[model samples]
Target: MRSGKSKRVSGTGSGSRKGSGRGRRPGKTAGTSHHAAYNAGVAEGTSLNQSGGGRLSGHEAKLQMNERWTRRCMAKGASAGTAGKRIQESRAFAAGFAAALGQPDSAWQPVQLTRSAAAVVFAGPDANPASIRQLLRLPLEEIIVVQEGASEAQFAELKALPEIKILNPGEPLGADVWRAVGARVTRADIVLFADAAQLIEAEKLAQLLGAVQAGADVALVSYASRLGPFREWDDLMRVRAFVNWTLGRKELGVSSIGLLPHVWARSAMDAVGVKMLAVPPLAHVTAIQQRLRVQACPIAKRTANESGKSYQGLPPQASRKLTNESLQTVFGDHIEALRAAMKLKGARLAMPDNSRCRSAAGGAE
Candidate 1:
């Protein structure tokens, strides 16, 4: 028999974990002007309340408003919901335009003076010498190839390209590759690290350098498939890449999408202390901890067909596994690491949208 008196529940069980619902909150609504305004504020680093007659100047207010709006759209996209998805996609479209405007006009004096950049490639004995030669052609002050005993034939082929240096580790593959690169990059302003199998498109290096001049300490290239052979695989890889990119932009406050023709400012790398590339493929967390301003630039025909059927060549599955492993590696200790980095760098880890980029441009060098 059941008792007539109802038993009292001890706790109100904390409301569903934040961001568990489908509807808007009291102040946050989708597609509304206020929502847009709030996002603009967030992006510009000012509060709505401070816009009208507060400490922020007119330019500051405008910048803040734009940034807030852009971030709102990005945040909405990163969140789960129909409205959120729409906001995210819309903002992404807008971001393209913002990126263009973000660049200073040719008439404007360059805000930052760019120094020579170095290209560092990590190759194995089986690496494609022809592809490596093609990469060496990119406009860079120097190119260094770190190989596990690069054959004399390969060295001779690479030597044909002026300003290219070949370094043999004569050791096992791993951290030593990165050390070789770090040592060779003493005089360079930036270092680009890519695999031997990857092929970079024209103007890719220039675009990366442009991003650095625009204030991004580290710029990575986004690639589209060259051959139709791996369209399905490439598509899948893109989805995963986008997801990872979105996560880093929204949740982690970092950029992690795109292929690894990673271009980094020498100062930034020195600040982080040069180390081997032991981190997983998606080095989002690692970069964040290093206080780097990472950006992703889309490139045409940046194709990398993994050599043979080896794990490196595998597409989406391999990417997913590597991403997971990266997350796990930093799950516990790295949270603090990221927080410290953010504080030190005063970094804001969010995907920049058109409005935000525009706002950034107003102050961009």
Candidate 2:
């Protein structure tokens, strides 16, 4: 029999978030609460990420921990195991996965990608297909692998699989270009873009997929760590912030479709037009103009994969270097977005009109 105090502690395992204490020795409080919660019949959500000494070993370690938690949750109560939610991607992406980990045996089941869903993965020359083993578990309708500068023999394992299509552009193409190509060909209502070299954990990926399945037009993996005081931000963050501000999406901060591990709805791609996807900032601006639902998932920065070494042919590099050399490259992309917006809605674009049309009163004309 669990006492009421101990039952309250179980909130950590059940995703209640009510028992966290910040009083003297916050670490002690959290540790005691986590242990007490586990003894009360459910594992804490933090267990998925916390390991020996609060360190992350890798994705494989987390998967093994999650599997154990699944079995234990089922043994406790089959009814509670089916608990799930369909909120916006932010909560749905974090709490949905964490809470479901305590209830269901099949954590991936709640986040199923429909037959109308597809995945576009761009593999570099040094990318290993084996890293995506868990992603193969999702019941996505189709998966298009766009490999760059890699031989057919490199992906032999996934080559013979049904529903898997590989495209070789004969030369190395950037990730955004691959995303544009995938958008042009895939005919699903929901689409996922991925890099073959990224070793994202299955749960983290599922939460992002879950968000899109819950009706988001775009599901971006939130790199919240990138945000802080404005004074400390780098040029990339500054450029993203500036573009987002001009687009009347100041609330978006640095989040953008240009970042990888994002999901999109086919309608969004069509609204922006397939060609615009090659320029993600413009595509994002177009989506906003089209009134699409763009959301950021709330997976913590700790969930980020920190172990992988950068591969030579990976194309995210092109995006990283686009403007770090000088602000000119980034300004070019933003200029195009502003130009596209003005073409549709006049010089004001979508920004609010606070002042009267001073341009109309100009006597110089």
Q: Count the backbone clashes (under 3 Å) in each candidate.
A: 11, 1
RMSD vs true structure, all candidates: 24.5, 13.4
The estimated TM-scores of all candidates read: 0.45, 0.60
For candidate 1, write residues 1-365 as lDDT tens digits. Answer: 12222221121111111211122211333346444432342233322333332333222222332344335545654321112233233332322212222311101101112345556776665566665544433334456677665678866666564445666656775432454354444456756666675544323444565567557777765433222344445333444344444335432212242245567776666565555244323245556555567665544323221121111111222222235544455343334444554554444434445556655566421
The residue ranges of model 1 lying beyond 4 angstroms of the native Cα positions read 1-113, 183-185, 223-259, 280-283, 301-365
Best by lDDT: 2
**What shift in Å separates residue 194 of candidate 1 from its native position after superposition?**
1.8
Residue 45, model 2: Cα distance from true site in angstroms: 26
Determine the backbone clash count of candidate 2: 1
Tell me model 1's lDDT, rounded to 2 decimals: 0.42
